[model samples]
Target chain A: MIKTFLQHELKAFWRARNTGKNVAVKIIMGVFILYLLLCALSAGFFLDKILEHAFPGQNIVIAFCGIILIYFIFDLISRMQLQELPTLKVQPYLQLPVKRNALAGYLAATSIISTFNIIPFILFVPFIIKVIAVGSGAGVAWAFVGSVFGITIFNNYLALYIKRKANLNGWIFLIATGILVLICLGDFLWHIYSIKDISYLFFGHLISLPALVLLPFLLAVGMFYLNFLYLKDNLYLEELNSKKASHKSSTEYPFLNRFGTTGDLAANEIKLILRNKRPNSAIKMSVLFLFYGLIFYNKPAMMHTDYPVVFVGMFMTGIFIINYGQFMFSWQAAHFDGLLVNKIKFNDFLKAKYLLFTLVSTLAFILTIPYVYFGWRVLIIHFVMYLWNLGVNTTIILYFANRNSRRIDLSKGAAFNWEGVGGTQWLISLPLFITPILVYLPFSLLHYRDLGLAVLGAAGLVMILIRSTLINKLEADFYKRKYTIAEGFRNK
Target chain B: MITISNLKKIYNNVLVVNVPQLEIAKGESVGLVGNNGAGKTTLFRMILDLIRPESGEVISNGEAVAGHENWKNYTASYLDEGFLIDYLTPEEYFYFIGGLHQQTQAHVDDFLSTLTDFFNGEILKKGKYIRDLSKGNQSKVGIASCLLQKPELLMLDEPFANIDPSTQIRLKNMLKSINKQHGVTTLISSHDLSHITDVCDRILLMEKGRIIKDIATNSSTLAELEDYFAVGQSVISSLQIDEEENH
Candidate 1:
């Protein structure tokens, strides 16, 4: 029965309407995975030397043991974000003669085949063989490997269980992520407890007493049983479909009522982003990227150079414009005909898009205010980028948006689902990223960094002042291609 | 109030809509009858300026619709599900449309009171998004939205196709009264000959992207249309047989 189920999945994948595109994406993903595996393998081979250099005079085995725990913690967080639960696919088999346990077991088993599972083995197996086996007996080395495998499987099932629960109640997802973030902060920032010391105490014991490996092995079995039982009890169609008992309340933007038609349109666009799956995910990702400056700005070496700061500032302030604007028109491809025939001016429509971009980029800029901890210069650069994103990048995004005729389905999941991407998305990035850089590069090359900042800021201010003229031109461009866009939308 | 001169649309070297000349007068309820792929929807799209013509143009109220926005001020159309913003509830969608035509919430409420029977108690206050509604209910929402604007011209494609039998009758009566009372210029395309003949003053028969027959809806109009379609059925059957044999 599991074999039959697997066969059906294979056929469904191959027979999908976007099979040709999916094949191309799969090839790219395959090459990417292979490249990552190669990097991990080489890193594993040199782990002993790296550890020796980092912790001079410390036991290399103890250092390796301490690092493994930290790696797993981060691995667990990534799995929580990226792993997809296959529960929905089991709906068809619920009514069949197959046992519920088997179906649940199959689901849990299939998730273990993920790249997350393989990548760790590629990264750590070599370290175990080269360092542990040569130092300790083969039995202890194999025991350590078994414990690693057990922990990997344990994280896989644990992530699946939490994600399934999160699907039913969004608070679960928030709480889980919150706890993980708190743990990371407590370890990295506060230094209240040393994770390295705790890891060394636990994993270092496994090297001498192979019996300690049973801890993870038993935990893996316990998690798998819990998942299997949960699935069995909640296999009903209604529970699987929408388990929530509360009705969703509607939101009212009372302040927006003042702007009349343009405000109404912008409000509708906001509701679209909040309510739909794909756009909602895009908005969530933008929120996640808000903290992106921490990764770059925290490094003392990075602060000396202005280019990286500029790049980070532009990305932090204008993330929404780049992420959401790429699908500006295609977002409404489902109803383009209705918009074209409506009693609204093309100019008003363009104005509404510009207003929306300004609103979001402004909000993003306000959110990045904390980045000023780095310096007031950082804040100034962000303000300029925000202006450029509002005045210049918005127009660029909308203009290129007109050229993209592909339709995007709003209900599909955003992860790895490239339904609407095309060559235009790639082409638009060049001007958006390069134009500002070109303006900055010449002045920066001459060591006139302040002048470079002023030039970028001036251009952005100029674009904002003449935005109405730019809108008129974009409106004309839209009229020229509305039919082709409509035709493309209708074909899908 | 609408004129099409030398209008044409082609897709991949195949002509989809080709009309040398056509005219619709003010307050004229026109019915377009055609089979699948007969360019009925295409013609309506062109009239609304949702699609551009290969040559010539659609002039609505003496203004060419392609580059002008004036026609939409008094024109309303619903061609398919594409016309609906499926994420909004029916009431929200109606209010949004009403707001576009400058109608206030209270005014929209008063107007919606007249559509209570047309809504059949399933659409308004249903607490469901338009996408979640049944197809028949969605059609009612679309038709109701089109009427909410109180436009000088209105267009609907296959309004009777997905609606229930009883609502179809009520809708036919509603359309007839709206046209009579307000002198609204209405254009509707449908496969139901009886409904079209009962509601429209003039019927245009289309075949293969061409208007084959134009007749006022008289007492015998339905019978004449049936005879033409019966002959068309025989020709289609014979062509299918020939293709099968050739293959």
Candidate 2:
């Protein structure tokens, strides 16, 4: 039965009823794998740089390990594709004499079948290839191979776990933050015991290879178990297919009667995000800004003052906000018809989105509070960023996002060559990421920290100030192309 | 249940839809029949307030629907699976719509009990996400949702397009019963004349953005209505024969 199911999945992929772009993405990833392979082969020339420490060859293993770890991060980050897991749209097949276990097993196994991990095999294996062949048994080589497979499956499950957790509650993030806190504070606690660098003991040591071997295996098992549990829990029709975004309109919401009924609409949008996938992603995206400061936190001088590079870095990520905002209209694309038929006010509709933006960016602004402690100047810059994002990027993205044609499968993970991102998005990103650099670079060239900071600040402020006009421009632009955008999104 | 007046929706300087005064009274079942781009959907949407009329507005319950706050509380529609929020199972979706108007799940379950034959049994127990369901099954879920809501106004466009024939008949009967039982006003659009004829009281045949014929299907036989649409009248046909013989 398992074999039959596996064969079916393989056939299904070949004849998958997915878009051309999805197939094309698989091909594109193949190219990426090739490039990664070539990079590894080129790096093989420096194999002798290996044993600088007692664990001289450890760095290569670490490099290989890093590859595994980072891919896991990317997998989790790109939660859209793998997060909810591909719902078995073909579950009707369950009644067609197919064993339930077979169907479930097929899904569980297919989770590990991706081409993303091919690069590590090409890079890491060759480093140990000669060493294993000459001395250790092929069992060692087999372990390396086994470990790699384990990594792939483990990461797949980790991503799935995070996604499932995220779908359920906010505690996943709280837990993740808690974990990060523990990692950072571990050294401080270890120092109190005058202990060794913790990371070096388990991960860096060779004997710990068994744990590494078990890591991926355990994760894969855990994930399969999760998949099984999810299926078991949601096997009923009502539980499986219901849109879960429903919540009682809390009468106590102070803002409810302000916009009157539209206030409820605004309140629903908040619930839509909180109860839906986007808000979690939006929160994750917001927290990502805090991680940026962490990346620079380790730098001594960089923390003391606002560095142009970091400022550009901070402002460069302004595109993410735009990216988030791009789907402003499309998210509601499904209900566009309802919005029309019900005679709902378009102004209220637009106002609900704007209100939604205010709510999100405010959350993001609060999330970025940590930057203030980085420096007083960072505060001014991010504040300008907040306004600029509200004023400029919000309009810019809504305008172009109003133009983006692809239908975003909100249920799918938004990572790793996912669809709905288009050429228009690229154009939007260019100005958001680069334009800030142009403003910052000129000031940096003149050797003025405050001036460069001012340039960034002023640009954001100007965008905020002209927001109304810009929004008007976007509205006009949207009105012009609304039909085409609407039509394209529903299909894609 | 619904009315549209002087509705003109211009797109790129073109008069895409120009619907002039339409009144659908309480519990009336109306079918909007239009050829491709005859402005049937645009008219429905304008009435629904999904799109603004460049010139006019739609009124519901003697009030402009466009300005009302709780129009949706009593208005349940499924334009397509998009409105279905495919993540939810059929039962979940029904309960959600049911819940929205302050109905309980047991109420919805009781309402759904009448439509057991239509469900074809067992998929409802599968907890299948609406996205995972087949198009026909999805339509069943959608139709069941609108009916379960017991909305005073239900607008369903192309509801029968992708459904299987058996389910189509079930849906036709379901819509009929719902309209009769609740006095729910329904505006359904479909290219399938037969399905419309089976359910609708009045069929508004639209061509080139105007209602060219308002056939009282309840009063007239399907054959006569078909002939009226074909424009193959006795005189027009005889003239065509003479012209053909001359050619």
Candidate 3:
């Protein structure tokens, strides 16, 4: 049964519509995992030397024991972010003669087959064999290894169980983050408790009494059983699919309704961003990236440089344009046909896009007004970039948007998702990021930096003035390509 | 109001839709009937300018649909669930469509109140996004949005396939009344022969990417379609046997 299930998964990956791109992603991921394995292997091999240098006369084994609990704490947090919950299409099997318990057990067992469960073994087994087995005998070394493996299993299932619960009630995630923060504060800042001491107490005993390894082994078994039970009870289609009825009332920007159809279309676009998961998370990430200026501004090395400041300003103000506008047409892939056939004119549609971009970039510019404390120079650059983004970058993004036809599934998470991305996305970023620098580079190379700023601002103003012509061009281009775009979207 | 000349669409060198000449008069109610892979939807897409033809053009109201924006003002179509914005509530979607056509919210509500029976009390104010609705309900939302446009040319592909029996009957009546009273030109494609013949004055039977028969609907149209499909099934079964013996 397990073999057949694995075969199905392999076939699914191979037979995916984007198999070529998925293969490329898999290869890149493979190289990344290999790099991490190397880092952990080297760290494992040289631990004794590093600890010896840090702790002078103390035994490195005791130092390693003292930090094991802290390692697991951070490990649990990272696992929660990275590990995917094991899911099977249980609906099909439910109607067959298969047992529900067997299916649940398969799901529970597959959760163990992840990189998080293996990394700990590679990092710790070498140290245990090299240091503990030779010094404290082989039986005690076996007990230490067993405890580490058991704890890893415990963390794996615990993270999955909590994430599953978090999907049901979002506060579970907030509460989990809160408890982790408090633990860090208690040990590192408040000094109310020491995780190191607790780790030393427990692992220190495991060396003398090898039989105590059963404690974590039993905990591991208990977590596995708990996951099995959860899966068995919640194996129905509704629970597994998680199509929660959205509680958000449909938003209406009445102020936008006054702008006529363009305003109504822009209002609908806003709802598209807020209501869909992929776009919602994507906008949230862009909003969070507004703080990107803290890295470059006020730095003595970067204080005098104007080009990097321009780059930073462009990014902070126009990140939403580049991120969301890159797939503008594909965002409506589901209803592209309806849109094409509706009463809305193509020119008005383009105007709605421009309206949306201008509104968002203006808001971003106002938020960056505080950067004036960095100097008036930083504020001026941001204003120029805001105009450039609204006029120049938006047009460029929409020009390429006509060529994009890959359908994006809006229900998926934005992080690490590569859906609807194609060669056009990679190529479109070149002109958006580099054109401003190229426009500013020549004047800055000579000592006429202020002239370069004026030139960039003037270019934006010109694009804004001739915006009607640009829309006419875009509308013509869209007319030529709408058929191809609609056909590609329809294939999915 | 639609005229097609030398229209052709090919997928991997296989002609999917190839019509030398076809015309839909201003107030004609036409039913397109074909088996799966007969290119019913593909032909509708070309007329709506959703797909570009390889060889020719679709002219709507004396203007080519390929590059003209005027056809969209008068033509409304729903081909599949892809025609729906699945994230919006049905009412929100209706209002958005209504807003595009310059219909006020009150006018839209009045229009919807008349559709209470067609919606079967499941569509309005249900607080469910279109994606969460059943397939049958989603099609109802799509069809309702089309009627709201008050378009001169209305096109729907298999609108009755996923709808309930009672709603299907109601929709047939609605299509009939709209054509009779408002003189709206409607082109519906469905596999249901009885329903198609009942609703449409003319029927176009398609086979292998070409229209093989164009029959004016009469009392004998349903039996004619049934007999054609019945013979087609037997021919297909015999072909399968021949291939099996060859293998």
Candidate 4:
């Protein structure tokens, strides 16, 4: 039965309309995975020597044990973000004569084949062979390998269960991430307890006492059974169909009523982002990028750098404009004909898009105000970049948006679904990032970086003043290509 | 008033829609009848300026619809599910459309009160997004939204296709009352001969991208359409019988 189910999945993949593109993406992903495996293998092969150099006079095995916990912590976080739950496609199979246990087992077993589960083995197995097997007996080394595999499987099922729960209730996800962050803070900042010591105590002793391998093996089996029971109990179609009932509350943005039709349109766009899966993720990702400054601003080496701060400022302030605007018309591809035939003018439609971009970018700029901790100079650069984003990047995004004709499926998750992406998205990034750099390069080279910042700010201000002229041009460009866009959207 | 002169559309070297000349007068209810792939939808899209014709244009109220925006102010169309913003609740969608036509919330509420029978008590206040509604309910929402605009010219494609038998009758009566009361220029395309003939005074029968018959609906209009379709059906059945006999 499982083999038949797998065969049907294979056929579905082969028979999809975009098989050519799907295969190309798979090949690209395959190459990327292989490269990551190669890097991990090399790092594993040199782990002993590197540990010796980093922590001289300490036991290399103890140092290796110390870092293992950190690796798993990071692995858990990455898996939470990137893993996809395999649920939607199982609906049809539920009606068949196949047993629910068999289907649930297939789902749980298939998840273990992910790259996240294999990457650790590629990185750690070599160390077990070269360091542990050579130093300890072969029996202890094999037991150690068994324990690592057991723990990897345990983490896989645990993460999958948490992710599934998170899908049902968002608070689960928040609580899980919050717990992980607090644990890290306690270990790193407060000096309350050491994860390294705990990790060394657990894995370091497993070599001497091979019987301790039962601990992780028992954990893996326990989690597997829990997941199997959960899936078996919840395999009914009603359970899946009822998920949308929890999302029924409607919101009214009363303040948006003031802009009349334009405000109404912008409010509708906000609903599109919040109510759909793909756009919701895009908004969440833009919010996540708000903290991106912490990576560069806190680094002592990057404190005095002008170019890095400028780049970060532009990204932090204008991220939503770039992310959301690239698919402006395509976001409404489902209803492009309705929009074209309605009483709304093309100019007002474009103006609504401008208002949405400005509103979000301004909100993002205000959110980034905490960067003043670095200096007032950082705040000034961010403000200038914010202006540049509002005046310049918004237009660039909308201009390139008119060229994108591919329709995006709003219901699909944003992780790897490349439905609406095309050459135009790639081409738009050049002007979005590089134009400001070009304007600032000459002044920075001549030791007048402040002058360059002021010039960029002034240019952005000038564009804002003449935005109506630019909007008129964009509206004309949109009209010229509206039919082609409609035709392309209708093809799907 | 609407006029189509020398309108043409070709897809991959095949002519999809070609109307040399056509005209609709003010306050006239027009029903376009055609089989699958007969270009009813393509023509409707062109009239709405959603698709640009290869040559000539659609003129509405003496203004060319192509490369112009004035015609849209008085025009409303619902050709398919694409016309709906499925993420919104029905009331929100209606209010949004009403706001586009400068109608306030109270105005929309007043308009919706008239559609209670047409809605069949399943659409409004259901706490469901348009995407979650059944096909018949979705059609009701779409048709109701088009009417809320109080458009001078209204277009609907197969409004009775997904609706229930009861709602279909109710819709036919509602459309009749709207036409008589508001004198709104209306265009609809359908495969149901009796329904179209009963609601629309003028009927256009199209075959292979051309209007084969144009007749004013009277006592004999439905029978004439039934005979035409009966002949086409017999030809198809005969072809299938020949294939089966050969096998």
Candidate 5:
């Protein structure tokens, strides 16, 4: 039965409309995984040496045990974001003569075959062999490895269960992430608890008593059974229906009504972004990236430099447009036909896009204003970049939007989604990052850095004033290619 | 209401829609009938300017449809589920379409109140996005939005294919009333011959991307269409029997 399922999955993949693109993505992802495994392997090999160097006088075994809990906490959080739930395509088989328990067992078993489950071994096995085997004897070392493996399995099933629960209630996912963040901050920043002490207390004791390792194995088995039971109970087609008549009230912004049709259009787009998964992830990513200034700012080397400041400023202020605008019109690929045939003017539609970009970039700029503590220069650069994004990047992204015709399945998760992305996106992003630097480089080289910033602002101002003309040209370009774009979207 | 001249669309070197010249008059209700791959929807797409033709143009009310915005002001069409923003609830979709036509929210509410019977109490206040509705209910929503536009030129493709029997009758009446009372020009395509004859004044039969028969709707129109399709079906079934005997 499992073999049949595998064959069906393979055929389905190969017969998909975008098989070539899917294959390319898989190969790229394979190489990336290989690179990550190599990093973990090397980290494993020298972990004992690194631990000894960091804690010169402390016992190396205790120190290693202290880091174990910290590692698992971070592991669980990363897993929540990156781990994909193993799909049980049981709908078709429900009418067949297959046993229900067999399907549930298959799903629970396949969920273990993840890189997240393998990375811990690659990261810890070498240290166990090199240091623990030499000192703690073979039986104790083996027991240590066993306990760690057991805990790894436990974390795997726990994370999967939480993610499955998150699917039914979105707040569960948010609350899980929030609790993890709070735990990290509590131990590291607030100093309210000593996770390291607790880790040493538990793992250190495990090293001394090999027989106690069964506790972890039992815990692992308990979690696996929990998952199996959950799957068995909820495997019914009716129970599995995720679209259970969503009772969410329709959200409207009455203030937006003042802007007339353009506002209404923009408000509609806002709902599209908020209510869908992929676009919602884009917004979440933009919000998360706003914290990137913390990593770049206040560094003595970066503070004195002009180019780094400009680059960081550009990234911070324009991240939303950069992230979301690359797939502008394609976001509405499902309804592109309706949009074209409706009573909407291309100019007004384009105006709505501009309105959305300006509003979002302005909000992003305001969020970056607290970086003023870093220096006045930082604020000035961010404001200038914000202006450049509004006038320049918005137009460039919209221009490239005409070239992207691939339909995006808006409900799909955005972790590694490559939908609607093509060579045009990569080519267009280069200019967005480089244009600001190019404008600033010559002025900085000529020892007139202040004048360079003024020039950037002036260019943006000019573009802003002539935006209507730019929109007109874009509308003409859209008219010429609208058929091709619509055809590409329709094929899906 | 619409004129097609030398219009052709080819996919993979196969001409899917090749109408050289066709005219639809104002205030006329026309029904297009064809089997699968008969280019009914493709022709409707060309008329809406959703897909460009390989040659010539579609003229709506004396203006070319391509690169023109004037026709959209008075044209409303629903060819498939692609015509819907599936994320929006039915009411939100109706209001959005209504808002685009400069109708106030209260006006949209009044129009929706009139559709309560046609909707059959399954669409309004259902708390489901258009994507979640059953196929038949989704068709009802799409047709309702088209009517809400009060368009001069309304086009629908396979509108009756997914709708229920009672709703089909209701829709037939609605189309007829809209055409007679409002002088709206409507072009509807369907595989159901009886319903098409009941709703349309004129019938067009298409085959292999070409219009082979154009007839005024009369008592004999439904029987003629059925006779033509029955002959094709008999040929297919006999070919299968011959192959089975050979095997």
Candidate 6:
């Protein structure tokens, strides 16, 4: 029965797409898996070489363990955003007499085969072949592999447990990260309390080789057991029905209500964005970028050149426009059929998207104001880039909204995601970033910092003001191409 | 029960649903038939106030349905998956439909008891969500939901397209009882001509957004009905007048 279930699942998953989409996805994942493997091998080789200088006998195990822990953390964090159960295809199994524990086990085992798990094996296997297994004793090499595999299992299972159990906030990830950081900086923190020596006594001590292998295995087993229990207990009632999908109780967003009908519509659109994961994540991610400058900008000496701020600022704004704008139509993909069918006043709908785009990018622009707090010149250039991003980059993005064929997972969280992807999305960034630089770079170089700012700002303001003109032309154009957009959005 | 005036939808100077002013009275079962893209679904959506016509008014009991989104609570409609909430179990789906119609769980319970073999204890289980169900099971759930409500205006689009023969008979019987017992004004659309004839008091034949012929089941003989739809026109078929009257 289990074999039949698995067979049915594979057939359905493949059959959900056309041959082309399935082939393309398989090829992409294959290339990605290979790339990860190569990266892992190099890191392992480098780590082993470094530790060999300090503690030759225990070097391979120490290097391998360190690599395993960092990779485990990375995998666990990624897992939080992933659905343990695939959603689109899972609906067909509901009426069957399939047991919940069996379903849960399938999800758990699938979690182990992740790309993150594959990467470490790719990197370490070669290093073991070239260095550890060749040069180190048999017991030493065997112990090293055992401990690394155990740690990988530990990371994979812990992530599965937390992801399956928790309310799944991004902060849970930050808290996990903070604990690891404290561990790394344990000497400094321990010294803060005058226990630096004791910290060294425990941390610096040499534990038996067997203890390292034993610890991760124990943790992995414990987490897997906890996951099984969670499945057994909570496997009864299905999650909330789509009709009653919980949301922040509808609030009177009078802020957007001032645009009259447009405002009211825009306010409702904003409410939709706030209620959904992908759009809301856009807001969350942009706010998080505000701190990226502060995180790495702690050292004044490393800032010998102004490259860091400029790169960070450019990258930050670029990230927002690229990530948020890429899914321009997909955020509304589900309801576009209804919108097109209804007497929605089409212009208002487009206006609502523009309103949303401007609102979010403006919020991002405002958050980046502290970049000026670095220095007046850094501030001016950063402001110019931001204004350019709003004016030119955003408009270009909305224009490509016509052509963007990226499939957005409307169900996934917006913060740090993998939902929207396609070759077109990667290509969109070139124009969004380059156009702004071309317009402003020459003017700034000619001793016109303030002038460039005014021009960029005006251009953005003009785009916002004249959005109606473009949308009018676009509406006519889209009517002719409605069939194409519909086919593309549906991936038919 | 329903009245429509100048019901026309124009997209880029092309008429999509050029339904002239028509009235469907209370206690009538209507089968709205059309070929692919003949505007049957469009006309239904507009009548239900799901979409607006370019220039028309649809009134239910003198209340303009266009301004009322809550018309469906009284007039049950299942168009595509628009009505099905994927996350709910069949029981929950039944409960929701029942709730909107102001019916209690006991009403649903009593209804289910009549078809205990068909339901097979699935209704009592709250764990299984609707999305996990098969297409045939989902349709059964949907059909079961509408009947549970005991609606005044029951609208279903191709409700029997994928269901098993056994379940289909169960549905046909259930709908026949509700229509006769409550005098429910029903509008059902299907490609199946036989089923439509079995149930509908009035069957409309549509082509290219126009109702070419409207046949009253009481008036027309099955031979005459078959003759009207024959591939080529004959002398006698074209000669018939006052065609909507009794057999």
The residue-by-residue lDDT of candidate 2 on A87-129, one tens digit each, is 3443556568876666656555566554444545654566556
Q: What is the interface RMSD of candidate 1, in Å?
A: 3.6
Q: Please write out the lDDT profile of model 4 over residues A69-134, one tens digit for every residue.
A: 778887887777666565326767778787888888988888877888888888888888888889
Residue-pair clash count for candidate 6: 9
Query: Which scores higher on lDDT, 3 or 5?
Result: 5
Per-model TM-score on C-alpha atoms? 0.83, 0.62, 0.81, 0.86, 0.85, 0.62
Q: Can you write out model 5's per-residue Cα lDDT over B121-218, one digit (the tens) per residue?
A: 99988787787788889889889999999999999988898888999999999999999999999999998999999999999998778998999999
| Model 1 accuracy (lDDT, Cα) | 0.81
Sorted into a CAPRI-style docking class, model 6 comes out as incorrect
The whole-model lDDT of each prediction reads: 0.81, 0.61, 0.83, 0.82, 0.84, 0.60
lDDT of 4 at A489: 69
Across B59-152, the per-residue lDDT of candidate 6 in tens digits comes to: 8876888644445456766655434544445665565445444556688778877767666555446455555566777666766666666667
Name the regions of candidate 3 deviating beyond 4 angstroms: A52-59, A169-171, A185-192, A237-251, A273-331, A345-488, B164-166, B238-247
Clashing pairs for predicted structure model 5, backbone only:
none
At residue A234, candidate 6 shows an lDDT of 46
lDDT of 1 by residue, B1-247 (tens): 9998998988557677889899999999999997777788888888887777788788899999888899888888888888888777787788788989999989999999999998989898767777667889999998998999998998999999888999999999988987999999999999999999999999999876788888999999999999999988878853321110111
- Candidate 4 docking class: acceptable
**Which predicted model would earn the best lDDT?**
5
Q: Tens-digit lDDT track for model 1 on A66-137?
A: 998788888889888766556326656778798988887777677777777887788778889998999998
DockQ of 2: 0.13
What are the per-residue Cα lDDT tens digits for candidate 6 across A315-384?
5655667667777776655434434433245566667666666676667667777766667766665665
Give native contacts recovered, as a fraction, per prediction.
0.51, 0.17, 0.64, 0.69, 0.69, 0.00
Summing lDDT over every window of 10 consecutive residues in candidate 1 chain A, give the lowest-scoring window: A415-424
Clashing pairs in 6: A40-A123, A41-A123, A91-B131, A91-B132, A94-B132, A391-A460, B219-B245, B219-B246, B219-B247
